[model samples]
Target chain A: MKSSIQRVKAIVFDTFGTVVDWRGSIIRDLSAWGECEGVKADWAALADKWRGRYEPEKDRVRTGEIAWTNLDELHAHALDQVLAELDLEALSVDHRRHINRVWHRLEGWPDAVEGLTRIKRRYVIGPLSNGNVALLVNMAKHAGLPWDNVFSCELFRHYKPHPETYLGVCRLMYLDPAEVMMCAAHNGDLAAARAAGLKTAFIPRPTEHGPGQKTDLEPTQDWDVVANDVIELAERVGA
Target chain B: MKSSIQRVKAIVFDTFGTVVDWRGSIIRDLSAWGECEGVKADWAALADKWRGRYEPEKDRVRTGEIAWTNLDELHAHALDQVLAELDLEALSVDHRRHINRVWHRLEGWPDAVEGLTRIKRRYVIGPLSNGNVALLVNMAKHAGLPWDNVFSCELFRHYKPHPETYLGVCRLMYLDPAEVMMCAAHNGDLAAARAAGLKTAFIPRPTEHGPGQKTDLEPTQDWDVVANDVIELAERVGA
Candidate 1:
């Protein structure tokens, strides 16, 4: 814990693994869909691989190696590549579009909704993610995650780890960076936010990358708050 | 009335005079403040002039005639000009800042909260105002207005009646222009939204400009929906 909690007026969260169980939700969703479609595939592995593609694909767009496109479009592009590699040729365009939206329909962790609802009663809570605004908005509606507002790197036309993404959110919220806390499961995200003068909270989602996840098992750097879950995080912050 | 109401999935409103009674609120607030400060000033005229400064100042920023500045900064600029003109040279900077935020403490019209709450149960309801996000957020929290989100022109770096403001909101919401409705009391705003291929809903706030307020007494154009107030608008749209 750090004394920075006294200055934090709003908490901007990292959504994918921090708030929602993306890997678990996607694996379960795709496994059910694949069974119904009579397709045999390792959906879990595919989910991990899809997550893996996120950085490289975004980097390509960010560095001007590729044209600018949104996260959904980027995810769809990667989905197509994975589908081809997995020999799932029978999947229709509509089906692929539906499947890509698995990112939109992620389920919150057991404590996520309740803790977030509590936090929202006191402070502004929103997603500061690489995911586009629509993706975050739709996910909030789907998961019943109550957000005061939604912020995305898409708003700045940049991705997380980029200082613009963190600062852009602060500018929109009319808060100095120090007054906004970035709550994430990943140290890399906390590091980026900390470097940008934002208060950082690390709540390790040990199973975010599924069982056998080795990285981000604990706080890699001194963060403002480190809690086991959003509920604990909320409790720690007096939400 | 447009036959196809289904095309409009979200209704983004204009705040201040369009949604809340800015002139009435400001006159009441400033008159009380003037009494407390023992200042003899025609507060009504000053309020009108202050509101009058909103458009041209934003236009200057929008067209690059002035550098991009948030509503707070713009309001501060106008406050200085109004203060000097009114010979209120004794007002301190802190008092000026407090007075400028009078916009954030507006009382909602009788039907505003209920009607907006109803609409929020169905459509995504937000204010796409020139007011920056924090102002709108605070106002919403203060007034208990049920906004699903806050979509300010500040996010788009342009002010209302600008195509970017309307189109940028639609783009950020991941909605087609046709899927979003511009709901306002002002015809000029609806005109811009219509020009941008978005639907329009006219809610007449006849007294928005107070006594002798001549403009926008009724809908000037054949908008998609015309209602007496937000309640009527919500009922007409099946909210």
Candidate 2:
């Protein structure tokens, strides 16, 4: 265990659901904006729909069906689709932009800041998310995530589940893949990271997709570390 | 002046000789290590010689004469030349590598951390150095520079004074060039940044090249802000 802990010198995190409560944060941001504008809608449903657009849009880029676009652009494009489908076209262009910027202001999970802070004391901690650089940097500042660095798929021009995004952090940090651990709530992300020679730690964000969340509520495979939250992750990693 | 300040939303720094006293740091590191290793040489002259090798190496990369190599690799190669010239061949491979890691342990200039902290309250502050990401990240951790992000030339595969590097930060931050300011102790770096349409702040590090420093003693051009040090830069920027 001591040898295992020593092998991992840096930990790269998956940002959206792993570190930040994206669904909760975005719902709150939209609901607040709607209240200010006197615009009414099922914000929870809208939030779910907006998030539901995320992966399919990224998949377009991943499959080379479209030119490389940053997360901000992808989010904006998806926002248009959601707005049209929800009939929230009452929102002005400025309002739509303000809504799109919600991703920049995500709040961390209850355990995120403390867990990352504790682990940061022992290892280099950073976000290796599919989010773009601007999105990740602004979110880090907004959420107080205490990242030692930012490694976004925008820097690599590839999204997560791609080998480039998983291995790019190692290249940038000049560390071997095994020296960097990938910590995420999603097993698919961990599987991809593991496939790329990175160590894997799984922490179940059981409420990530709300109470009805059916998938990724627990580790599906024997990962390097399985914890209830980031604090437990730190302990298991000997941080 | 207020308009200029309001226009700038971020400030990118030149790390070596700007936020950190690289000459002083390198000289002290080499002198201490020499004493411990029972090696004797003119460490000051060695420091100067080592720094003198810096730009020429990046020039090789910039001119496409060599493949893209990070600052750490470049520094190691240059260290070998300096060791050979100074007859310090008694140093083992590990000893040489340790000496090259001096760049990662540089101390911030006396006013750097506080001034950076002050400015960071309003604007995004980060290093826009030719140093690689690993080097800049390690130095920030070592010296407590409050950078919101790290921007190294290694990210763009081009060295500064290249237009891509200065403008790359603007693209990453999703800001217009005019909205970003380049703060540096070196006039040359500021000049390149200014040429790339970035706002320029010149802070003189008169002793950067030791007591005989003959250049960058003051602003040589009509830069946007000319301050004595980073503290004054914070003041001028209204932080």
Candidate 3:
């Protein structure tokens, strides 16, 4: 019998923390910008707090408490609150715009490009991210990611962990859920993928939230495949 | 003063005959297969008849006569009708499946990949075709087209030249219609894009409908940029 791994006709990834290091990239981007602009603040703290606000901010739209908002707006809104909280409010509009777009310029993990490139030869590959379509496209161009397509929550008007998102990518491809694989660093994401009748792969991004991060250090369950990083995931998938 | 061409942040394409030589490709593929299988038929006539059915079949979904059927279903349905009309029906299941997939395996016009690759360096590029997402993705992979992403009418559940389809792509990109350029060989497609407020590029594939093709030989309107081919498109776009 063919293995379930061989059944994955396409693979969709959770981009932030899984494929790109959002925390490190954002902190680095803001710190460099601050130094250039002669602005002083705890950039790392801002990154952390802004990311902390993300779940709550995203939840508002996810639960219909707020109107559908894309990631760019969510990030910009969260950035404002985090900046005010950190006493670094009153940024120039241009500076704020640059900082918010840092998400669009997030650097992919070391193995991301090579691994995805290899896997792409066999199965269709893309980012099923909460990022808006423009953000995903810009990120792909910036990171040199050769995604077959970009799946934005904006496309479905539904956030991840919502079954709509997990299955939406499959629906667009005219694929059965069983033929799709969801790859993510976060176990919760993989759990949702499995619950939605898709296969799963866990590739831990241990430093996703920076060196002190303790969560998502390893796969919490028996995902279809567990690999050290994207490179290993590519190898395990026999690409 | 910046020309409207300079305002284009992303470019979307009409794929079938614009980016790929669908008529020649389908004819060549079916003819070669027929030769190998010792089945004789007028492959060119079949190709033309099949393409002739495309617009009407697609218009069914566009006009809401049928529920949102994707391109794959529409193509398969049309192919069956063309096959019966040409007295070439009753092929084996696998043979029929292979014939149906010729669209996904289309070869790009001679300059398509190189030109699009150059253009992509300056702006995001994708196919804004009536083809479904899977079809676009597979075509890109097969043709070595380095698209930043794939756009399909299936995503919007509306077909061209519907206003919703044109605006939906801009909406997902968070861009004003004027910031997006629609590049196509068909004058009618360009007219639709122009009316929808997108900047337009016309690159003539003079033989897109084969040697007898007369339509879209020269752009009927003063398009934003009229190029010899995609190669000239890359140059005119200043990529």
Task: Please name the candidate that would achieve the greatest lDDT relative to the true structure.
Answer: 2
Query: What DockQ does each candidate score versus the true complex, computed on alpha carbons?
Result: 0.56, 0.73, 0.82
lDDT of each: 0.87, 0.90, 0.89
Which lDDT tens digits does candidate 1 get at residues A101-178? 999889999989999988887788889998987788778877888888888778788888989999988887778999
Q: Sort candidate 1 into its docking category.
A: medium
Q: For candidate 2, lDDT tens digit of each residue in B1-239? A: 55765799899999999999998998888789889988788988888899999989888888888999999999999999999999998889999988999999999999999999999888888999999999998899889887888999889889998999988999999999999999998889988998999999999998989898899898889899998889889999999
Q: Give stretches of model 3 more than 4 Å off.
A: B92-94
Which fraction of the native contacts appears in each prediction? 0.45, 0.55, 0.92
lDDT of 3 at A37: 90
For model 3, residues A1-239, the per-residue Cα lDDT tens digits are 13977778899999999999898888888788888899899888888898999899999997888899998999999988888898777888888898899998999998999999999999899999898998999899999988988987788989989999988888887789999999999999999999999999999888888878899988899999998988888889889
Residue B130 lDDT in model 2?
91
**Candidates 2 and 3, the one with greater TM-score:** 2
lDDT of 1 at A68: 66
Ranking by TM-score: 2, 3, 1
Clashes of 1: 0
Ten-residue stretch with the least lDDT total in model 2 chain A: A1-10
Compose the digit string of candidate 3's lDDT tens values, residues B104-198.
98999999999999999999899999998888988898999999988888888888898888898888888899999999998899899989999
Model 2 off-target regions past 4 Å?
none
- Scoring only the A-chain of each prediction against the true A-chain gives TM-scores of 0.96, 0.97, 0.97
Q: For residue A137, what is the lDDT in candidate 1?
A: 78
